[model samples]
Target: MTTYYRDGDVVITSTGIRMHGREYALAELRQVWHRSGRRSWGTIAGRGVLGLAMLLPILVGALGVGIALVAHASVAVTAGLVGGGILVGLAAAPLADVLLERVDRSYDRGSRRREIWGRTRHGDVLLLSTADAARFGRIYRALQRALEPSRVTR
Candidate 1:
């Protein structure tokens, strides 16, 4: 007969490491504490904002052209308005790209920790090297004990 130790709210590994939250597949790990979060949504929102900002210049140009067409204004005036819009859109593209890159880098740096291991909503996993196994074990044990249910009910 095989006896399986079912975890009751808390699960500990054979190495005395306490498992917290949902466990992720090892293959899914990209970097220490840095994982993609709602990337598709962010991409869509970013594009939408940039598109809206770009449309402002086009709209202004269209209004100017409409006025010129209706009032028999000079062709130079209409062309200048449209050209200005194009120039503004062109400048915005690079600015938007730079802003997005900075945001992504900030998020990546914020998620990283200098500690041997860190805990997040995802799960608690050891990030220490072989040389620090003993120290890691001590911390793991401490965390496990803290997570365990209290024996004395209040």
Candidate 2:
């Protein structure tokens, strides 16, 4: 039989597919499909809250400087303080954006998962999953073709 895909311990041949120590014969395989897992909306919202927290210092500093200037602080002294605060805040915003991007990447890297399932002729189910959804989909479609060549449609 021809081997269509192979990565690490997983292998897919024309006769069978194997992953995570589970195996299923092509003839015994009755169905192949994929399903998405639960989403992490709460984690996403938490990250947005943290991003706002990072901007809090800039907001509070600007408000304090405005109040100080109105209370008759020397123009030169107030300007220097305000200017410095603004620079720090301006620098912080981009840094916060970069940090949030890194955080988002890490979160997505961990959460990118999909389940590949196969139902056998005996009605037993075999399952596997990976963070690589495209790879999983490719393997599922290949199995579908190999197991049901006559049943495949254009």
Candidate 3:
């Protein structure tokens, strides 16, 4: 069988598609279409919220130190607060990194996602769903190319 697309166990071939251990025969697909919509944002943004939670106490402490400095507090107390806040902020760096990474991914993944669907003898079926637009485009185009040979008149 000629493989139009192959990625791990998921494949598109002359005969059909095999993904997630499910098989779909190409002959059974009468028509195919694409769908795009928003993805669930809560999970990604939630991490940022949690990060904000973690940093709030640090921020409040810093603000208190600033006020103390402005009010001519003793040098030893100001120095201690500055030193402690630095240590705590440094200690929380990894969690802050995670928060920033999640925020970046949310932007990269964007608001919309893509899906492929096909009409078959039994009914309509979902062929693929992904947040990765590049992969989706590649697979969808491959499916189109694989089906094209059958549609041409000899």
How would you encode candidate 2's per-residue C-alpha lDDT over 1-154 as one tens digit per residue?
7787777867878888788888876766666667777765765676777778678768866876676577677887778778766776677777788777866665655444678776665674646777655666677766666666535221
Candidate number that wins on lDDT, 1 or 2: 2
lDDT of 3: 0.74
Candidate closest to the true structure, highest lDDT: 3
> What's the residue-level lDDT of 152 in candidate 1?
13
Write the residue-wise lDDT of candidate 1 on 117-148 in tens digits. 44434665554422223333454444434334
RMSD of each: 13.9, 4.1, 4.7
For model 1, the local distance difference test gives 0.44
Model 2 segments beyond 4 Å from truth? 1-6, 13-15, 57-65, 68-71, 110-113, 130-154
Give the best candidate by TM-score. 2
TM-score, one value per model = 0.31, 0.64, 0.61
lDDT (10s digit) by residue, model 3, range 1-154: 8989999756999988886687888777788888997766775567568778668756866765666567666888778777776666565667667767776666656556888888878887887888876778788888888778666211
